[model samples]
Target: MTVALMWEARAADGRGAELLAWVRRQDLAPAPLRRETFRAPQDRVLVITWWDAPYDAALPELPDPPAESVTRAVHRWRFEAVTDH
Candidate 1:
């Protein structure tokens, strides 16, 4: 089964774009099968990566963003794909 990891962070005031750029530049390991990024109000950025492995598999994950660029702790969630179209 495939698995997806969702990571989110709220950038410090007026730093959303910078945070997203930094994230794009950082090297996340275990190259994902697919990846997507989203941004929202309040400087929130979310990144979801799909991996070719089970949910319980040990997958490489993105490291925490620089403290100065984040307003709150990073949030992460994992999901296993039940079906794919």
Candidate 2:
């Protein structure tokens, strides 16, 4: 089944860009990563990524745990393909 993995993180001042750039360079084998940005009312930066891959193969890589003070949180979501008229 195809799944969509989503990740969100907030960085310190002048760190969001660097963090995003680092993520772009990461080699997420097996499946590719698609990133998007969202604006919060408080101006906090929010980044979301969608990855298409199998549940078993991608779960481990999706929520990559917290990286000390660099990443606040990593979220993941899995969705099954829907086909209907």
lDDT tens digits, residues 25-60, model 2?
Answer: 555555445656554432234445455566656343
lDDT by candidate, in order shown: 0.90, 0.51
lDDT of 1 by residue, 36-84 (tens): 9899999999999999886799988888999999998999999987865
Local distance difference test, candidate 1? 0.90
- Over 4 Å off, model 2: 33-71
State, as a TM-score between 0 and 1, how close model 1 is to the true structure.
0.92
Predicted model with the maximum TM-score: 1
Q: What TM-score number comes out for model 2?
A: 0.54
RMSD of each: 1.7, 4.1
What RMSD value applies to candidate 2?
A: 4.1
